[model samples]
Target: MNVSGIDIAIQKSERKTVSIFIERDGSVSARVPAKLNDDEIKDILEAKEYQIFKNLAEWTQLNENAVEREYVNGQSFLYLGRNYRLKIVKESSGIVRFFRNTFYLGEKDQPKAKELFIQFYKEKLNSKIHPIIERYKDQLGVAPQQIKVMELQNRWASCTPSGNVNFHWKCAMAPIDVLHYMVVHELAHLIHNNHTQAFWNEVDKILPNYDEQINWLKINGSGMDL
Candidate 1:
């Protein structure tokens, strides 16, 4: 619906949530649970849609602003389960350097700060992810056809019917054990293909503390920044 003449893309899911998003153009889409009937949802769109859209828009903007403020120019982020700040600098020197408790990125070219954040994450943390995966692979005895790292939107990691495993790059943001658990979880799917009891048993046999990783992901593992 148009709040200030913006068009929105609405998405409905089975999960329990009700939210509205303000498009960059000022249009808003009301995201609601699938449990909501068309009539109930229609009433919302017909009445108070503007107010609802505006409020959600404000909240979205505020949250984005906070993230930008915290992540840019001399801000901190949790990486490899530790706190690392983005230290903006003016030197022709290290654009992204890691000290004892901080990550430094040169802001001489501030336009690419986000890109620098990503590059720093990849270069500094990727080497560490493989060893964790190898440890679990040995424990599981079942190996995925292929392991791929990428940015995931809906699911943290996925196992294709072909037995390939693709992990969300953000999994790097999780603790070491948690990353291992995810690798093992996906590897288990390479054998089981579904979330059945035997599948869970396979997981428990190799990763006894799978529940902890599950809880961690639930509490802390998702972001599209939108």
Candidate 2:
């Protein structure tokens, strides 16, 4: 349903309460009770109009900073919050390597550069993620079955029903501190399944300034791409 110049995706479910959230593409979605009629749905949206518009505006502003990258020489890439200039070389060797403030890539590997970078991200995530998880496992009092990094849309990380924590490889692109926030945020989910106040309190206990990391992702996440 398009309301007041904003497009809202309405989903009906057996769930009792109404829930609304903005997507990564700056779109709005609301899950309503399956029995609600169009009129009732409209009323619910009307009642939450203020919140809808507020979040929509924030999404718009945040996505305005989206970055479009090219696999060309002199392009800049982000690794652990630092900017590194790309240096394309004709020599066929490693697909990507970081050295002396530059990210070196093989010119012949241009077509496969994205895949190589994904592997690089997975490598980076594997190196630090487990240690961080171990650091917080005792505090959160929950142990994950495993940690895996993969490509994901719309979320930075998620906790599985079986207690596995999966993170998006793109997460490796963020600052180490921000990455920690993602780890702790997902770890908190092991104890609480929903984003209730208690869940947030758990996150706060692990990272007091988690809101800053969240805001950082809000503003810069669009640029955290291949």
Candidate 3:
């Protein structure tokens, strides 16, 4: 849907209020109440035009530093929020391996470097997030049905009505403190569905310095990619 010269992909769901988001790829999405008609949605979009434009400008500025990486020796990659130089080795038992603060990729795996890196992140994220989830679920007094580390497109993390929490594998590239904030953000959703004050209050209870992590992501997120 294009409203007021802005293109937005509209998603109608069981949600109560309209929410606008600037996706990671610089696309706009609006999640609206399923019952809203096109006219009503248009009106809402028009009303929020200023905010949307402001956010889009910010997204543009932030993504200016987006990283375009190569699968070559001396190229850097992120692991646990730290930069590690990539080394293509002629022989390796695995497609990719991390050792001594560096990423080692088998030369034969060069054709599938992106896939191998994604697999590496997925495996590492699966192992890393479980313990963090366990620690927070008990503190938040909520239990998620399941936790998954997978491709979530533009979102770093999200929670479902059924209590399932999903984290993007790219989150493995964030600093540990920022990763903790992501975990707490999703677990808090099990308690409050929206970003209301009460919902943030719940997050603040667990991570008082959460804003710092949020800012860190805003500044560094565009570079956390293959």
Candidate 4:
């Protein structure tokens, strides 16, 4: 849908309220209640036009430093919010391994470097998230049915209606504190499904400086990709 020269890919879903987001690739997406007609959706978009433009401008500024990483030696990759240079070693024991503040990749696995890195992030995020979840679930008094680390298109993490929490593997590239914020943010969703004041209050009770983490992600998120 085009509204006032802005292009938005709109999706209608079984959601109650309308939500708009600037996607990872810097595209605008709007999710609306499935029952709304096209004219209703267009009116909502027009009303929120100012916010959409502001977010798009911010996205453009932040993405100015977006990194296009290579699979060669000496290229830096992020791990736990730290940049670690890649070392292409001749060893065949594993596809990729991290040690001594550097990532070691098998020469034979160069073609699959992206896949290997994703798998590495997935494993690390899986191991790291559980402890954070355990720490917060008790305090929040919520027990999620399951936790998963997987590919999420436009979110760092999400909580489903079924009480399952899912985190994007790229989250492993964020700082531990940011990881905590992400965990808290999703867990708060278990209590309040929307981003109402009560939901933010729950997160603030846990991580008083949660805004710092949110700022960090807004500034550095573009560079975390492979």
Query: In TM-score terms, which candidate is top?
Result: 3
* CA lDDT, every model vs. true structure: 0.64, 0.87, 0.93, 0.92
Per-residue lDDT over 1-226 for candidate 1, one digit per residue giving the tens place of the 0 to 100 score: 3434445455676645556654433346777678887666666555666676566656465444323234465456767665566666667454557787776766575666666656666555467667766777767776667767766554668988887777665565668888778778888887776556888999999888889887665445433221
Per-prediction count of colliding residue pairs?
Answer: 4, 0, 0, 0
lDDT of each residue in 1-226, candidate 3, tens digit only: 9988889999998878999999999999999999999999999999999999999999999999799999999999988888999999999655689999989998888999999999999999999999999889999999999899889988999999999999999999999999999999999999998887899999999999999999999999999888
Q: Candidate order by lDDT, highest to lowest?
A: 3, 4, 2, 1
Ten contiguous residues minimizing lDDT sum, candidate 4:
87-96
**Cα RMSD of predicted structure 3:** 1.6
Clashing pairs in 3: none
Q: What's the C-alpha lDDT at position 63 in model 1?
A: 42
Candidate 4 local lDDT, 75-141, one digit each (tens): 9999999999999989855567999999999888898899999999999999999999999999999
Segments in model 2 whose C-alpha atoms lie over 4 Å from true places: 1-7, 10-17, 31-41
Q: What value does the lDDT take at residue 12 in candidate 4? A: 82
Rank by TM-score, highest first.
Answer: 3, 4, 2, 1
| Better structure of 2 and 3 per lDDT | 3
Q: List the residue pairs that clash in candidate 1.
A: 6-27, 75-86, 76-85, 95-106
